[model samples]
Target chain A: MLSVAEIINLLNSIPVGYKSPEDNCFNAANQMYIPEYKKLGVITVANELQDNLPEADENDLFCDVPGCQIAFENSASYQAHFYNVHRYLCSVCRRCLPTAHLLCLHILECHDSYFIIRAKRGDAMYSCFLGECKVKLPTPKQRREHCINKHKFPANYRFEQLCGKPYKRHTKKPSKSVEANEIVDDMDVVADIPNMK
Target chain B: MEVDPDEPKTSPSTSRSPTQHIRDRNRQVAQQHREEQRAKTIDTVRFGLGEVQEEVEELDELSEQDINGLITRITRRKHASAEEMHKLSEAFLQSMDNIKLFFEAPGALQVIVKEIIGLDSGCQVGALECLCNLSLGEAPVCEKIIHQGGRNLVQCLDSPDERLKRTSLWIIANTISTSPKAAQTVVQMNIVPKLFYIYLDDSGEKNIANEFREDAAVCLQILVMGKNRAARQEDITFIKDNMIKKCRNSVAAEYHLKIIFHADIVNPRNEFNIEQTHHLMDFILGNLYTTPDFGSIANRLRIVYAIRVLSNMVQCVPTTTIDAMRQQLRGVWETHLEVLLNKVFDFGEDLLSLEVVYLIRNLIHDKSPQPLPCQLDRLEVPNIDYEKLLPQEWK
Candidate 1:
């Protein structure tokens, strides 16, 4: 995983190729090799690190689904995990996504109604922009459509952001532009700031 | 379900000889009755509190006004006595109203937090006690402490002072018990695993290094004493009805069906995310039965809160999580069966015994018991008389 610069810097810690080892240097004071430790220890460590790190082949990838612990041989196998095992059903929507990538995107674009509106269904419900909506929709797609068509919300009118990002996990970028009604300008704290006419 | 005399008359028993047959019937009926009684009372085992009672930590009492007066005095004074601080700290848990009063005061929390880091052992212990008691039964105060990076409170667990370490862990544990939000926060700070590791480190010279003359595992055990009283309906409604205005997640929200059940509207980010919910499930699955051997009264009290917190958590879980957890639940279910087999039969504490039923009932839904991270085949066949214990409608 070390970049070219990192490798060079690590190599530079070896005193043999350059000059005498620094007196107070960490590499000089303590390293695995006592025989020319500054040079040998650093080189040995770098070699061991490279050798020990699992290459991006057999065991490099894993299924990121919360509980599925199987590792993959390659990216193709990793992608196959979704189709083979994980059903990719959103808890709210109940629609099955074809792939893990699409599943992530579907949750982002659809699941919005965050409140348990009435006694019609279960005691509690899920929502995206939790308290803002009056009536809660059961599915993510319905909630997203409700926000845009019923509420007359702009295409890119985000329900909310968490930790400066959109409410849900980011998967792929939107295929089409989510045109905002108006530009948000330089202000960062959107909650406190009033809408500009 | 309706039994008829005709059915009994038609049976082979009517045609059989009397004495040996009568004895066999009596034996069968008696065994059946005994089995039914055992099944009905298994989870409801309540140990005699006096018999298994461990020492509850003592806190010198303080009045409601005395709490505020003490804080104000601490803030105003350049130096304070250890005795006075300890008394004040003990007094903090005495009243929820006073905790609210102290928190509502500006800079009081920061001042008390500063005292925790001071050189004076009395002030440190007192401040830690106040902080710990502040966590008991008060969600808002717990949230405040959790929000302020847990007041660097978790770091105090590493303190050489045993009183300081115990109090710190207790405070953190108490905070987690207040709400899922508080638990999520402390767990995120990456202390949940630390507690597990602390419990694991019971051998070697390191044991002698511990200052409390207490067991190394006690801090972790105390941390999971479960949800504070605030989550209880009576306590929650009492607070809601008495207050002049409704909190965003108060009783009104429950009626209205709000998503962020534990979040304040003004500060919405404080609620648990799905990942945090996963973390809670993970924590419970792994640590729920970490208490010392069963039948220990102290251990019984510890798991009550642990299971209660789990009950509160799964209340918010969606169906998908249940599906995902189904496979991993087998191991947890095995542990649950193991614990129940060992400790629960003689479980005599009323609260502990009662909470077990609540825990089991909460796990079941409709006809199918969801993957509750536990399995119970002992009571699979229904023989107990529900009508005897339950109401007419429940029956």
Candidate 2:
């Protein structure tokens, strides 16, 4: 059902003389008239206004995730989508954000997602990092920090650099330091210089 | 060949039934008899010199029918077996007189040398030994044998079998020693490293390996000493840096010093590291008495070259540089001078008399701050058993 404000906003967008009795489809509560359509009352004018309003852009109405592109086909559908998909109810906008908000939050909160070592299995996903490393975030930045601190990957940005293969991704880990004896002996040609010392 | 009673009878009068069985049994018996005859003929044919010579003449003078029969007989003798091949090469060497005639027989000896080297059998050693003796005796023909498929000898140097490599080194050394001109072809082939590796491999004290090392060192020493200055420079540096120093990596220090006794000590100007030259001298003086006199010529000449070069260098280099040379040679002068002096006075009695007199004359004539006199207290004269000594004034 259209809210009172949405109905009024739709009517205000049109010129005064555009509606007629035959143009009315939905029976609206409020009506207005101009000289061109005096016979048309609230139902005709409201339906004409509803039909004249431009369609909402698909991207603007839908959340960014793959399956939610047509979540808000109607006001009731939008409400149900927010309630069911996002489980979020926005008090100020009078909009329920459910699964759609879940996706938006996933994207916003974890910038480090790009660096997350993920293995996509059909519709499901799993983290490939070894050992008790179950953590998820929306963006690559947060996920990268999470990987470095939690997973013992190299904390440096170089470790996070892409390996240029999608299947074999990076979870940044620190390289071990050269052994003391090896530094002194096998690396004589490389480390013996005064600068290296 | 006594007939066995068990032999199947194939006569038409006997056994009409199972004729196929009887025929099969007869064929097996005939085949066994033929095999025994072949083994016997291979054993009896003499490959010795007079016999082989007669055979060669026969080969040359035979009627076409006789030649066919001779080929058929030799074909029956399998040269593939180790015992057969060894005996055959021994026979070939015994028939060394006939080998000379085959030199002109288009690839005869080359084929034999190649076959010897090519086979899995151990006849290569005997075959090479025969070639070594022949080359040493007949200098003119060594090049032909070596040039015609003698390169298989070098390939033997890289063989994983140490014995094969050792024998190859000996044959190659003997081949080069037979004629100095052969060194050009041998060096062009870059065989210097292979020879050095075998000379340095200490895995075997086996007589063959030891002999190979000694003979090769001696031959390389002489070849490097050839009067060609460019060859001398390249060859000497090659021996010092590549062969002598590389041996240190594989050989015991003592054995390293032992092989160092073989390095050629030709024109030693400023080419070698002065310190290395001193170290080499010390090695020579250490082995002067201990090393056998026959193979020690290269070591002896190396020492003399060091002494002569040090002597000559003082006159050429500035006074400041002379101090460095002296510092480098301090090890030799301190440690081994007395032993070298003894060898000079003793075994070199006959050889050094005229050279020493000439050296003394040059010493008196060529004076540049008079190079330090060979210190007397550091010298010891060993007994000169084989060499004749000069008179007191001449000494």
Model 2, span B1-395: residue lDDT tens? 99898765555534556867556546544654454334323322323223444444422233334423332433454233333233333333433343354344444454356444332223444455445434533455667656653555655555444344554565565556556656555664446655655566566544521345554554454345333411334544555675335432233333343233223332223354555554543443444434444234344444343333333333333343344534534644453333444455554443342222222222223243446434433443222321232223222
Candidate that would win on TM-score: 2
TM-score against truth, every candidate: 0.32, 0.42
Assess each model's interface with DockQ, reporting 2 decimals per model. 0.01, 0.00
Candidate 2, after superposition: displacement of residue A78 in Å? 85
Best by lDDT: 1
Tell me the spans in candidate 1 whose CA falls farther than 4 Å from its real position.
A1-197, B1-69, B77-81, B149-151, B204-395
| Model 2 spans with C-alpha error above 4 angstroms | A1-197, B1-84, B116-119, B123-130, B133-137, B202-210, B228-233, B243-269, B284-350, B353-366, B369-395
- TM-score of B chain for each model? 0.42, 0.57
